[model samples]
Target: MRSTTPRIDVVPAPTPAASLVFTTVLTHGPLTRIEISRRTALSSAAVTKAVRPLMAAGYLVEDADEEARPSLGRPATLVRVDGGRALFIGVKVTGDEIIAVLADLCCRIRVARHLPVTDRDPGAVLASISGLVQELLTEAEGFGVEVRGLGLAVSGDVDRAAGVVRYSPFLDWRDVPLVELASTVTGLPVTVDNDVRALTVAEQWFGAGAGISDFALVTVGAGIGCGLVVHGKVVSGAHGVAGEIGHLPIDPLGPPCHCGNTGCVEAIAGDAAIIRRVREATGAPVTDSAGALELAHQGDPGAREAYTRAGEAIGRAIGAVVNVLGPQRVIISGEGLAAYDLFAEQIRDAFTASAFGTAAQCDVMTRPLPFEEWARGAAATAIQSFIGIDTY
Candidate 1:
C-alpha cells in the first residue's frame, strides 16, 4: 500500500535582493552584514533589510563574533543559514540504480539510500522514487522540519523548463513528464534537470568550482558529459542541450555511437566503449568495467592500449572544450576516475597536443565524486528552484 503524500507548504517568496543575500551567505558564510553587503553589492541598508525577514522566518541566524571585535564599534554579528530549519530530498536515476539523499536546507546530506533499479519502465521508476521519498520524509519528521522540495536528476537531454525528460538513452525514455509525475506522487514541488548540470550546480555552490566564475566539469564514466559554468551561471543552451562534449566527432572513422554518429568522443571513451575495445583487443571475456580494468592492471598490453585510447579521446574532448570556452579551470570527475592510473599519461599527453597555444594553460584537475554527491547535486537543484533561481 502507498502512503499518503504529504502536503507541501510553499516557502514565502523572497525578494530579488533577499534571494541574492541568502545565496551569498549560504555559499560563503557566516559572514558579517558588512561582508554580505560587500559580496552581494547590496548596500548596508539593503543587506539589513534582506537579513531581517530571513532571520524572522528562522531560515537565517546570527552569532556574535567576539574575536572580531572592533575597537571603534561593537563586535560583528555573523549571519548564516539555519540548515535545520527545513529539509529536502534529492534523487539521481541511473540506468541500473537510484541514489537518494535527505538533505538539510544547507544541502548537507543527512542520510542517503541506494536501490537497484531492476525495471526501466516509467511506472516502476516512479514507484521506487516515491518509496525513497517517503522514507526521507519520515526521516525529516525527526528533525521537525518540512521537506520543502524534491529534485530529480537524470542523464541525457532533459527540458527542465518543461519538466520533461525529452530523451534519456540510458533509460530508453522520451517525453516523460517527470516533474509532474514525481510531484504528484511525492506531494512536493520537484525540479528536474540533466544529471551533469545538477552536479555542476552543487560544485558551483559548495565544491571545487565555488568562487570560480568560468569553469567546466567533464565527467567521464558510462558517458562523457560536460557541464559549463560561464559568468557565474550554469549555461543551459537556448535549445536545452549545451556543452555536449561527448558528441564531438574527433575521429570520423571511429566507432559508432549510440547516437548514430561515428567517432564521437563517447563512442571511443565511454565505459561500454572501453569495455568493448578491451575485449576485442585482448580477446578476454571482459564483461564489465571492473574486468577490463583488472586486465589493464595485470599488464595486458591490449587492455592497457584500450585505456590509453580512451584517455586520448577524453583528452581531445577536453581540449575542444578549452579551445572554445577558455574556461579558467577544467575539473575531471565521474566514476571512471577509478581507472585514472591506467591512462593518466595518455590523457595529459593528448590534451597538451590538441589544446590551442594559450588554451594549453588551462588548469586541468581531477576529483572523484561519489554517487552520493550526485544525489546531493539533485537536492541543490531543488533548493535553487525553491529560491526562484534560474535552474532551467
Candidate 2:
C-alpha cells in the first residue's frame, strides 16, 4: 500500500563526507573549494565530489569568489547552500508554551509561532503541535519550497533513534512515541530529540561551539539542562541521557526534586525552584519567575537570597560537569538568564571554589536566548535528518 505520509526520498548526502562538506559550507559558506578543503580536511577532489550532488540538487550554489586576488590568477568560485531549496518546521515544547518556527534549508527561521500550553497531556501537546505545523506548512507553500520534515524538541530523556520520549519531567510524560504521533498528524517525517541536545547541535555547527572540538551548553530556566559536545560530536550517552547535570545532587537536604531526589540542581536552580523559594522567603505570593524577579529587582532581601542560592547551585553543578567532562567552553543561556544579574557573583564564586585545578581556566560565558532559538534548534535537527547527518 502506498503510504500517505510525506517523505523526502532524496538523500541529500550519500556519504558522511558529503554531509560534512554540506554543513561546513552551510556554517561557513561562500568559501572557495580550497578553503572548504582546508576547513573540512577533505581533499580538493573529495570536496568537489561531495558538493557535486548537492549543487545539482539545488541545495548548493556556486558564485564568483568575493575575496579573489587578481594577482593570483582566475578567482576560485565559492560554494554556499541555497537556503530557498527547501523548508523545515521546528517545534519546541516547554512546560508552559510551544514555540514553532518555519526554517529554510540553511536553518534560518522565516516565520515563528507561539501558543500557550493549557495542558501538558500528550494528546493536548500533539494538538498544539498540529496547529503550529499546519500554520508553518501553509507558510512554506508561499515560499514555493517543500516542507521536507518536522522536528520536535522536548525536555527530558528522548531516544532519537526510536523517536520515543522516554520520560519528560516537565510534561509528566513517559513512553510516548512522539515522532510517530507527530508524523501522523503532520504527514511529514518527524525527528524527536531532547530539547537541550537539539540546541547543542545548532551551537556545535553554527553558533559558539563552531570549530570548537569540545564545549558544553548549560541552559537555566524551567530546567537546568546541559548539552555536551566532546571531540566534535554531540554526546548522547550510552543510555540516551548524557549531560544531565540538572539531576546532580548538590544538596542532599536542600529541596525535593520532581524526579524524587533531594537537592538536585534542578530542585535548587530551576524556575519553579526559584519561584517557590521566592514565595517562601518573601511571602510575596509570586506565581512565576517574572514576579520573583520583580521582587529581586526591587531589592527584596529574601528574593535576592533565593537567587543567590540558586546561582550557587547552578555554578556548583557546572563545576562538576567541567571536572568530569573537561569541556573547553561552557555556555550558559535560556530565559532564566533574566535573573542572572541577581546571582552572577554567587555563581562565579561557587564555580571558582568548586572547579578543580586547570578546569577553573575553562571559559564560561552566558548568552541570552529566547525560546525561538530552541525552536530553531529543532529546525536544525530537521535539517540534519534531511541531510542524513542526524545522530539517530
- What overall lDDT goes with each candidate model? 0.91, 0.90
TM-score of each: 0.97, 0.96
- The TM-score between candidate 1 and the true structure equals 0.97
Cα misplacement distance, residue 202 of candidate 1 (Å)? 0.6
Task: Give the per-residue lDDT of model 2 (tens digit) for 321-348.
Answer: 8999999999999889999999889988
Write model 1 residue lDDT over 118-147, tens digit each, in one string: 999999999999999989988888888888
Model 2 regions more than 4 Å off: 1-3, 8-10, 390-392
State the displacement of the C-alpha of residue 221, model 2, in Å, after optimal TM-score superposition: 0.7
Q: How many backbone clashes does candidate 2 have?
A: 0
